[model samples]
Target: MRLEQQPLSQVPEKAYHLPAGTAAAHGYDLEVTPESAGWGYSGLRVVTLAAAEEHAFSTGDDEVVVVPLSGAVSVEADGSHLDLAGRADVFAGPTDFAYLPPGTTATLLSERGGRFALCTARTDRHLPVRYGAAADVPVELRGAGRSSRQVRNFGTPDHLDAGAIIACEVITPDGNWSSYPAHKHDEASATESELEEIYYFEIAAGPQGQPGLGFFRTSSSPGHPIEITEEVHDRDVVLVPFGWHGPAVAAPGHAMYYLNVMAGPPHPAAEAQGGRAWLISDHPDQTWIRSTWADEQVDPRLTGERS
Candidate 1:
């Protein structure tokens, strides 16, 4: 399935903001393929299964990582079997995952059903099937004060041995902001890499189990102008083909979590540098924000000092 690329001049206003259930297909709650996204790489799928149920698919030309959003899952691929000890929920902590190389058929079965995120990127390289332990993931607390957020670098270049996909998870406490300083990686140069990005979000509910919401923003960049500012909810996704995007803000009573998927062409200057680098340039006007973090302390909730 291929979709003709829409000229940037004619890109739809709402094309980047995919609301929950809007992109459902192939038995997945949400499916965003490179073809469907009008980009060359980066895709994501959110799937849910019942107890004892299974889902199977072929990797085709894309390498994939099976990340459990909730509950445990058993994965079988390329004659290899992996049991991911998933967490109770996203906020429960990092969960184990399975990486399936390209050109393989894989099956996922859960004794006690749950939701899973399939993060993918188109690539020609065929690596081996491997499992990533939750304990091995590097968790970083970035920024400070209201800008503080927790980042789970599970499938980043320095950590995982993969071809094109660079994925991770971020959690921003309620009323906080993340992905700040408004950065852009739309230009391929000595300082920046041109990568298309996908943000799949999940907001935590309020004390009474009320629905949660957050906000995301993206503004115009030099040659690639785009604009997006929307209230995002659980399962909502935002595509960043180009532009300066930042300050994903969690509402006053709702913490926000998002999975980031990115991929792009390799830099010619550094052929050995697999297409796994995440180089970005902060919006000049807001670059000064980084200096403020030196004086402020990280949010207590993220430092385990308080709940």
Candidate 2:
């Protein structure tokens, strides 16, 4: 199936902030193209399907990873089918995912209603389609105290065979902070690897199913200029091409979950010298805050269990 494309300039004036349903297209609840982001590499599309319903689409010139956010899904591409055992929710630990290379047509089917995320990147190179098991995903707990957060490294350089794309998920507990110290990867150097990033957030609802809220911020870097500070809700998106980003604060009443999609030129030399990984330059003014983690304990709510 061909995707109904939209012009990039047609994106809302608030370039960084995209409310739920604002970027909808075809069967997707949120569709963000490279053109829409005004960047060259990273993009994302989120789709919600009903019981026994299926959605089909082509990858075109981009490669995508099919990740089930709330339910199970079967992904078929290039005559290969991968059935994913997904978690009940983002807070439910890790979920299996499938990767589709460029020029491949794929279909996603769910027996019961569910939501899925297609984390994508424009690429000229075509890789092999494959499956990623949740059992192999690395869960890392970073920072301490209120700065604590859980990271599921399901699609990182050392974990998957993605060409340029590097994706992951982060879970921050209520009243806690993640992405602290304001980091930047906008410069291409031995210390930093320039990359474009997309942040898709989902605030956990309250006990009575009340909606939740969180805050996101992105400030201007040395030469790169960008300024964004907004209260984010379910399905909200933030695009970061060049800037210092951080402190995605989950409000006291709600836990926050965000899917991070990143892609850019690979630095083989830097990898051989150091290590192939996402490198960031933290804001010097607040860099000292990291030391305080030694005095605080991680939030007890970070129980890495899936049901």
Candidate 3:
């Protein structure tokens, strides 16, 4: 069955509508409505924190990913303090991504605060908040035979066996491709795998103020062909329901960025079903991962009026 899809371009550029009185008198950030209809009850949206506000952000009944699109911020969890300021200056390092698992509480302070986009998953799927540092964590190169690169994989280098929900953030360099060839893990077969996916895109303008855009093509089936050509800016997203989604496309002008939030019906949930898999077929010419380490990651120069 074809699912209801929403494209960022098709969606009118609407300002976030925060309920009146929601903003506290003191340093408090406003939350934007994460309105999307693709994955069943799962919630996805963008929450922006202001500079003047030093809100103590936390989560409840859901797994959340705290990603700073731009600017410096401080994140504390499990009695550990991690500073995300000037990380880019440190060898083109990335902004830290904090995954808040169920029942975990934390506080965020934005000294020179700007805005942060938080993607939360609402379901029985529980992902304990994990804080992984790109500078500290060792990246393992996976995917052989034309596909090769490092995956955070979590603090533990192990494959998911319980159809557990996962949140992964990768830094794709300029003119380089991530996600590589088309692959699907919709089946819950043994200790190997089972899961569905939702790709949320966040991009900064490429070099010379060139807009960063992501390319995506859906399988040519009876369902629908969902394509993204919106010249995505920061805080833009494209939803995938059923199809072979690949080549998390990036243009030569800018390095494309995205966070993947995934969850699916595990085999245990489907007692009658043999396995869990709803992956559609993919087109030809869409196969490649990594072989070379590529070039250095140039930071995206944020320009053209910071919204």
Best candidate, TM-score? 1
**lDDT order of candidates, top first:** 1, 2, 3
lDDT of 2 by residue, 174-253 (tens): 99999998899987786788778999999999999999999999888988767779899988998877789998999988
Q: Compose the digit string of candidate 3's lDDT tens values, residues 78-122.
A: 676666552432114444666666555677777665666555654
For candidate 3, what is the lDDT? 0.46
The whole-model lDDT of each prediction reads 0.90, 0.85, 0.46
TM-score of each: 0.96, 0.92, 0.60
> Which residue window of length 10 is worst by lDDT in model 2?
1-10
Off by over 4 Å in 3: 1-35, 41-43, 56-58, 75-86, 89-91, 94-97, 103-107, 123-131, 136-163, 190-194, 204-206, 220-234, 267-307
lDDT of 1 by residue, 1-307 (tens): 1224557557796989999999999899999999888888789998999999999999898999999999999999989999999999999888899999889999999999999999999888878999999999888888889999999999888799888888999999999999999899987898898788999999999999999999999999998778899999998999999899997999999999999999877655545656567788999999998888888999988853211
Candidate 2 stretches greater than 4 Å from native: 1-13, 268-277, 304-307
Measured with C-alpha atoms, the lDDT of residue 212 in candidate 2 is 98
Candidate that would win on lDDT: 1
Q: After superposition, how far is residue 284 of candidate 1 from its true place, in Å?
A: 0.5
Which ranges in model 1 have alpha carbons more than 4 Å from their true place?
Answer: 1-6, 304-307
